[model samples]
Target: VLFMGITFVADGFGIVATDVPTTKTVVAQVASTVFGPDSLGYFSFQGFTALILFLAANTSFNAFPRLAAILAEDGYMPRHFAFRGDRLAFTLGIVLLGAISAGLVALFQGDTTRLIPLYSVGVFVSFTISQAGMVRHWRAERSAGWRRRAAVNALGAVLTGVVSIVVLLGKAPESLLVAIIIPILVGLMLFIHREYGAQARELEVRPEIVVGPPHRRERVVVPVPALTRAVVQAVNFGRSISDDVICVHVTDDAEAGERLRERFERQMPGVPFVIVESPFRSLVRPFVAYLDVTGTKDPEAITLVVLPEYVPRHWWDRILYNQVTNQLKRALLGRPNTVVSTVPYRRES
Candidate 1:
């Protein structure tokens, strides 16, 4: 309010000093005329105004992180946002706000006149929602003089909502962004709320259940792609776990399967073969089918599927190969009493 009063006075003097009346009142231009351009007074006015603007910018810097923390606590945002940084600050929120502000400043090319209208629309919309919520709260409480409180909030909401619409329409493109973004944000919040509610329902503990560690049940299934050193090592790992180490292979050709079995004879002598012929050439589907067979074969057993993953040196090499380990893991996750394990064999450059 003080700033507004000062600006109002300065602007009145600014028009007469400049003589040519312009609707777009530049703050620096007004300050220059009011306090004599390039003088101590002009610079003082600028310095003070800059300080106030800096403080105003800090409002977001301070507020957003705390808001983010609250949202995060309520599961509206990522849990990481609830954590404080080294200096006990909401660093993620601060950094994000800074980035957003920088983008907006760059977008408007630091045009305060253009920026204000867009800023005002979002602010007014927020005010409207907040006031409306208060009115709802007051009505629900039904305390002494609740009617007055509700009336106050209802009036504020109506005024702000109307102002927001007017400002939005008056500034076409700028307020158009607000109209689009506000709805998107509301939708996102609603989605988060639904997800939280669903998770809560899913996680609710039943009244009766025996929670205790019992006798162990495990069945390790090692996938044999080839007679490579990596495959040999993975099979060796499986052998160490139990005497019933089964080697499963999904082959496109029966001839290739026979050849691999011959190679396995020399490489892995003891491990039994469970060869699956896949005519479709779909790795994930065949692997998932094998898991289903294992699941039904011994429904009470823990089917541990161990995969041998080759870690190549180059990024391009990694990209060239199918990410079968991750794909297989994702596919096997839904299977009951089953676990997918991966052993990475780093190849020499």
Candidate 2:
């Protein structure tokens, strides 16, 4: 209501500033006298339109992310979009929406007059459907004499449906058919995806309930970075499980590779450190390839890739180091018979 009132006031002020005569008979009216009255009116309309578009864009930016999060929680979208980033709420969704809006703005050349009728029709249709659904839900519950609630909701549905029909009649011939059809297609796709996901969930395997003498043992793969306390802890933990333990390292440079090998030889005499030299200077591919080779060599082995990452007290410290550990973890997760774990090292503040 406050937004509506402010918009109304702004629109009124714009009209008054451009169309209304300030003085009864002033000889000092310079600007309006130079440009024609119609020109001034057009300029004012354009300015007001720009202001409304700016407001609409801001509102969309705020609303789209929240909507995306809600959809993600409901399993309609990827789970990553459900959480807020450090500085922005639904950062990925907002970026994606911005890119989409940019494409749309370019396609339509930012013409609101052409877009308004197409926009309102779907809104009214959705309103009508929602009200109808509410009416049906109230009718279904029967508690506290739901007839009254149903009647009220039915009235809302009727009003919205009438408005929607009027809008369709007024706008369909005027390039709104394409807009309406696009949304219908999108909604259909969403429905199909939801159904498919539901079926997939039903077909998914449940964890076993068998007890005693586990059929398989876990394979622990410790990522050998340096002879640090964290590395020792990881290796010790992996050894404690009485399972196969392997150490992995990727070499992008020969000097760094030889240094890491010597450090492993000196610090971790018992543990075997396998280094895969990366021709492309990429960590993910080499690490994943190593996992594949290990798995092929011992098909029964469960490869657990343990990565040690430094937890910085200050955010700036994080900016200096490239996130190779996180990348390696993600890559290992994509391969079969492989599990990745992270051991965090906290730096002194």
Candidate 3:
């Protein structure tokens, strides 16, 4: 009704729609004409319209994130979308929507004429789907007034569906983008749902399965780079847990490996040392390969890879030492029945 009134007023004023630069300022133009173009009423009306538009723009920010969160909870979207931030808001969804909206605006160069067709198609399609769902609900419930409610919803669905199709056909060149994007989004959601289902099935437990102690035995493997106090501390901790502790070292030079092995044997007597030769001087690969070999030997035993890390006196001093422990931890992650433990040795200030 408001739009119709504006159109009538603009026609009466002899203001040609083509002469108007953009559809967005039509209401302001109408007000300007009514108030002699310079009156306070003209400027005030424009201010009010601007305020309303700003408030209207907030609807997507509120709706999209909540819808995304619900979809995420149902396993049709990424799980991160369902997580609430410190402010109890769906921060990721809000940020994502903002980014996509900004990208679309920039892509179209903020031209309302070009963007409106896409908006209209999306809005009417959603309206049609919602009304159709309501009609289905009314029929399923079949209450005393269901026939009337269903009839009204059915009419709405037909009207909106017609509008959606008409807009798509009329503005195919512009609205085609939305048509293409919708199917891509649907495909992505289906992929997420399938992945979630596969993961759930893999982790599913059966009633026939009897639960017992996790592992039959525990074997600790400490990777030693040098005969430092940190290495000795980790080896001691490994031995305290189980007598089956093996210290490993990856060295390209055999002489250096022998010197470390001698020092390790002398410091921690009776503990076995395994030196892995890495011709390429690669650390993580050779270390992980040695672990895989040991794991293959005793599949039932848990291979606990304990790494020794020296704590820098100052936070900024950490860059001086190589982050071998962090690298090894990342490389060994997700290996079956393999646990990575870190033993931090605090250094003196």
Candidate 4:
């Protein structure tokens, strides 16, 4: 009746001369017909629309990250995603969702009709899964009120499952794309789970190994970059961890190596230093080669590869500095039972 009155007012007052009587599909159209364009009411209608849409989006921000954190805890997603920000929000998941939403908006070219069907598929799928899980939970406990809960869950599961299927089958191409994407996501999640399991096995402390304190020295190796505050700090960390610290410097120039050797002797006189002559002029390989030599000599002892890293004042400054640390860490980590440690010294601009 309100819509009809709006149309009547629109036609009578000659506000918007359009043949959109039966088809007031657009919200703005109906709004303009009721309250003339550029009026307070007109702006208020659009404002409320924006507010409601944003509230719906905020729901996604809240829900998806918590779900991702749960998946991470269950070993189905990367542990990094489970980390919360200062505000206790899942920062990675929120950023990931923002990127994904942007990509999706671009993909659909801002067409809501095309977008709605895909959203419906996700919503119903989640609903169905949650209901099914709840049913299982209630059945497992079988406590007081479990029967009622199970019945509710079962009903919800059936309803949502049916709706999910209908939405998926009815919407062609878009729904088909979602179906394809879901399996790929599942495959990725499975891969993550497998990796987490493998890592857990590798890092697990067996009862046999820890039964006795076997005779082994902790050999700390500090890969020497330019002996700045960073290197000094890294060496200090190495000293704290272990008494036997060996500083290895790799250089193509024999003359520069001699200079560094002299400097090491003058500054860090007590600690042992080795000059690795790398004719190939590569940092990581020569360092790894030296580590391999150390490992072969004393197979029982654990080698601690301590690399000094400088965290610059800003993020862009990171590219200018931290390249050597990652490559060396990667190479060092491959050697079994060897722990790679980074001593970060933040550099102020």
Highest lDDT among the candidates is held by which one? 3
Clash pairs of candidate 4? none
lDDT by residue (1-349, candidate 4, tens digit) is 8568757766675556333345433556767767887899988987887797899899998989999999999999999889999988899999999999999999999877778788999989889989999999999999999999999999999999999889999997788778888889999999999999999999999877656665788989998866788888999999998999999999999899889889988998888989999998899888888888878888988898888877678778778888899888777767786999999887564
Q: What is every candidate's alpha-carbon RMSD to the true fold? A: 4.7, 8.6, 3.1, 5.7
Off by over 4 Å in 2: 1-119, 142-159, 172-214, 225-230, 240-243, 249-266, 274-287, 297-300, 312-320, 323-327, 346-349
Error of 2 at 13 (Å): 20
The model with the greater lDDT, 1 or 2, is 1
lDDT of each: 0.82, 0.72, 0.89, 0.86
The list of candidate 1 runs beyond 4 A from truth reads: 11-26, 78-80, 84-110, 139-151, 212-218, 226-244, 250-270, 276-286, 292-302, 309-338, 344-349
Q: After superposition, how far is residue 25 of candidate 3 from its true place, in Å?
A: 2.7
> For model 1, where is the 10-residue window of minimal lDDT?
16-25
Which consecutive 10 residues in model 2 have the weakest lDDT in total? 23-32
Over 273-313, each residue of candidate 1 has an lDDT whose tens digit, in order, gives: 87898998877798778878767866888777888887777
Candidate 4 wrong stretches, greater than 4 Å? 1-47, 144-152, 201-214, 222-243, 249-273, 280-283, 306-327, 341-349
Clashing pairs in 1: none
lDDT of 3 at 136: 95
